[model samples]
Each structure stands twice: as structure tokens, then as C-alpha cells.
Target: MKELFPLKQVMGFAFSIFFTLLALAVYFFNMSFTIGMTVLLVTAFLQAGLQLVVFMHAGETEDKGAIYTNIYYALVIALVTVFGTLLCMIWGYV
Candidate 1:
């Protein structure tokens, strides 16, 4: 039956493998450092998001809005904190 397929888990596993290969390719294929790093970062984040959504089921519940809001807030706080530190440390703006 369809219920026996475990479709979501399977897809998540497949995507995770694909992303792993993508990151490895970026690292081993002699691409420019900047380009390779950019590709790896994008793919890594996308893969993490996919894992969260599919495996953790972050979007499946009634509190999905709250979950997303929390995630957004965390990201904003992280960005601000990192930029503030960098601004002070690197730019001598302390």
C-alpha cells in the first residue's frame, strides 16, 4: 500500500545524499575558491532546510507559523550579532 512507502523519508534521504555529493563536487572539482564556497554554502543551507522540513516536519503542525517565526527571529538575531561583532572588530568601529 501507499502507506508502506515512507515516501517523505526516502525523498529526504535522497536529497541529503545529493547535497552531500554536490558539496563534495564543489570541494574536489578545482573550482575557484569563492565559487566553490558559495556553492557549498547554498547547497548546505538548502539541504539543512530540506532536512528540517521533511524529517523534522517543521511545517506539519498547527504551530508551524510560530515555528517559522522563531526561526526567523533566530536568524535575524544571529545576523545582527555577527555583523555587529564584525563591524566592531574588523572595521575598528568599537
Candidate 2:
């Protein structure tokens, strides 16, 4: 019954837990702001990608190309919006 055990999902879940704990370590260890933020961002992106591919099955469809394209577009838009706001409000570069 190995084929019916959902191994991939289990592994993904375990990896998600590991990443979560790693992020938490940054907080508990009292890392510098830059280091903590870097670690958190890296773990967050990795977990998000893992969830998308493993849990959400982003690559298991016939239209996977379209799905990934949409994801890329959304990422670009989000980055632009965030950086634009930072540039105007925080960086004083309006």
C-alpha cells in the first residue's frame, strides 16, 4: 500500500514544519534585524513555493504554463506595488 500512502504530501508537510521552526528560531535566538528578516523572507518564500507545488499541485494540470505565468505576473505586480510605496513613503523619493 505504499503507492496509496500519500508520501509526497507527508514529506511536504514535514518540510513546512521544519521551515516554520527555522523561522521561529530566528526570533527566539534574537538575531539582528537584517539577519532575522533575511531568514524569515527566505523561509517564507520557500514554504510558499513548496505549498504551491506540493500541496496545491500547481504543476499537475494541463494548463500549468498558464498558471505559472499568472503567478509570475502577480509577483511582479506585488513587488512593484510594495517598492513603489516604499519609494514614496519610506524612502522619500516621490
**Best candidate (score: TM-score):** 2
Error of 1 at 33 (Å): 1.9
Candidate 1 lDDT, tens digit per residue, 17-82?
A: 999999999768889989998988899889989988999999999999999999889879988999
For residue 4, model 2's alpha carbon misses the true position, in angstroms, by: 0.8
Which 10 consecutive positions of candidate 2 have the poorest summed lDDT? 1-10
Model 1: residues with Cα > 4 Å off, grouped in runs = none
lDDT of 2 by residue, 1-94 (tens): 8899999999999999999999999979999999999999999999999999999999999999999999999999999999999999999996
For each candidate in turn, the TM-score is 0.87, 0.97
Model 2: residues >4 Å from true position, as ranges? none
Candidate 2's TM-score: 0.97
